[model samples]
Target: MKLVVAYIRHEAFEPIRLELLELGFPSITIIEVKGSGRQKGITEQYRGSALTNYLRPKIKIECVVADGDTQTIVDTILKHARTGSIGDGKVFVIPVEQAYRIRTGESGEETLQIHPDAAAAAT
Candidate 1:
């Protein structure tokens, strides 16, 4: 299994989620995060005054999927999250050692069976 972690522009969350669902990769967890890369955060203008904020608001989306589904999910996130500018965010795919559903005691692949997309798609 692979764990896909993506830090994306806050505004791109909805589209990414919808696209992931359409691509049959819907199981995900999202969190509000703040961080920066090369360009760092950005400047904001308020009341005719400009303020530089180094920590930008971003959305972190995490999903665990079969190894084969890694690329597709990464591409989907990149496609929708790109803004042709710095600080667009990044995606990381990590190997998942194991997983288990606490409620049902389902482990490994069975843990993912509860995911509608994973269950519907015959990967």
Candidate 2:
């Protein structure tokens, strides 16, 4: 298993989501977050004054998928999230030791999938 975490601009969320769903990987977690990277934030003007906000908002997308799906998920995020802008955000892949589904006590990849019929219906 692997964990794919991506911090992306708000504008890219919907497209990225749809792409993942169509790819049959719909299990994901979304979080609204604030942070900054090499872009170092942006400067804005208010009341004839300049204000710099170091933290920008990003939507964090987290997915625990099968190891084989890691690359595809990252590629999908890149395809949808890029805007050629500084604050476009980042993607990280991490090793996952294990995973579980409390309801059925299912573990590993079994817990990360949707029934084929259900997945197709969703798309």
Q: Estimate every model's Cα lDDT from 0 to 1.
A: 0.86, 0.92
- The Cα error of candidate 2 at residue 62, in Å, is 0.1
What is candidate 1's lDDT per residue for 63-109, written digit by digit as tens? 99888878999998998999988888889999999999887677887
Q: Tell me the tens digit of each residue's lDDT in model 2 across 6-101.
A: 999999999999999999888999999999898895899999999999999999999999999999999999999998978889999999998887
Task: Give Cα distance to truth, residue 5, candidate 1, Å.
Answer: 0.3
Candidate 1 residue 55 C-alpha distance from true site, Å = 0.4
Superposition error at 89 for model 1 (Å): 0.3
For candidate 1, what is the TM-score?
0.83
